[model samples]
Target: MSIISLDSVCKSFGALKVADAITFEVREGEALGIIGPNGAGKSTLFNLITGNIAADSGTVHFLGEDVTRQSAMQRCLNGIGRSFQIPQPFGKMTVFENLLVAGSFGQGKSERAVEQAAADILDRTGLIGRANTVADSLSLLERKRLELARALATAPRLLLLDEIAGGLTEGECSQLVGTIKDIHATGTTIIWIEHVLHALTSVVERLLVLDFGKVIAVGEPAGIMARPQVREIYLGIEV
Candidate 1:
């Protein structure tokens, strides 16, 4: 069954339409990748799905229930967890403290449970060594890992990642891809929006292309990449 569904979702900012009758469904445990040009509204689409913004029309459904009007926190507690492209950890908080907050508030876990979950999440995200380090003191890659870790601390059924691999070296991107692959192995459905094609292709089985805020193509990654329209729009190639 589809864990999340967007039916004819539409949104606009003044006269600029960011989403125009956008519709798609993500099956349980499926890994779907979204790719588009800079202004194609990929992040806006994530915001719509995660309740960061309400759609102007249509419905956003999770587990077959409509949550179009739900707040972002409510959606998080309802099993939607997401990581932004820019890591937004509490600067003064330790890495572990950051996860502790996410577990407690995002997942509504008890203090003890939150502590244990934070520890496990740190270990899983390769941030165990930096547990006591302040979030602001971490390196770029560590910060990115912490961002992903905090999201996992919520124990979400569906994960939304917005360009998590952005601004990373090739080696760093490879390591992050390995971590994401492990996360997917454990049955968490993931929808990732990334411009780093290699990192995205490494993790997602299906790919969706967006152009001018509309879904232009959806299919197996290889097939989607082969399309003339996708190549022209996303890869800057004429075919």
Candidate 2:
């Protein structure tokens, strides 16, 4: 079943069209990878779906309900959780506090429930040791994990991840892949936009390639990656 669907969605900024009649469906419990070169409007697409920006036309459906006009917070509360490409934890807050806020606000849980959720998220994201540490003092990888953990604290049915593997070492990326796989195992639907192809491919069974706000390819990961157009345009390799 499709948990999220975009139909003929269009968005523009001034004269530049960021998304053009975009359409796709993300199945419940599916992990999808999105890849494109810079300026491909990948993040714009994420914003559109999550209601950070409204579409100029078309409709977005979440869980069989039309949500094209929903606010970002409404969509978030309705089960859309996302992590930005940049980790933006509250600098003065502790890692546990960060998750506490997300869980409390994002899920609208009780204080006790939020605290329990935050603790579990810390463990899952491998941030248990840093739970009491201030967010600003954490290393880059820890920040990324916290970003992911905060999103998980929302208890979303559909998680949108934007470039979470951007600045990790090879080993660190591998570890993140493992963490993501574990999350997927819990039946959370995921749509991840990433430049680190190996890490993205490790967790997503299907792939979508976008360029100039339009989908250029969609298929199984290996087949999509092997396509000449995808290789040339996004992968920067001749096939």
Highest-lDDT candidate: 2
Instruction: Name the 10 consecutive residues with the lowest summed lDDT in model 1.
Output: 230-239
Name the runs in model 2 displaced over 4 angstroms: none
lDDT of 2 by residue, 1-239 (tens): 89999999999999999999999999999999999999999999999999989999999999999999999999999999999877889999999999999999998877787898789879978899999999999998888888899999999999999998998889888888998998899999999999888888889989999999899989899999888888888877642
TM-scores for the candidates: 0.96, 0.96
Worst 10 residues of 2 by lDDT: 230-239
Q: What lDDT does model 1 reach? A: 0.92
1-239 per-residue lDDT for model 1 (tens digits): 99999999999999999999999999999999999999999999999999999899999999999999999999999999999887888999999999999899887878687898789889978899999999999998788888899999988999999888988888878888998999999999999999889789889999999988899999999999998888988898432
Q: If candidate 1 were superposed on the true structure by all CA atoms, what would the RMSD be?
A: 1.6
Residue 82, candidate 1: C-alpha displacement in angstroms: 0.4
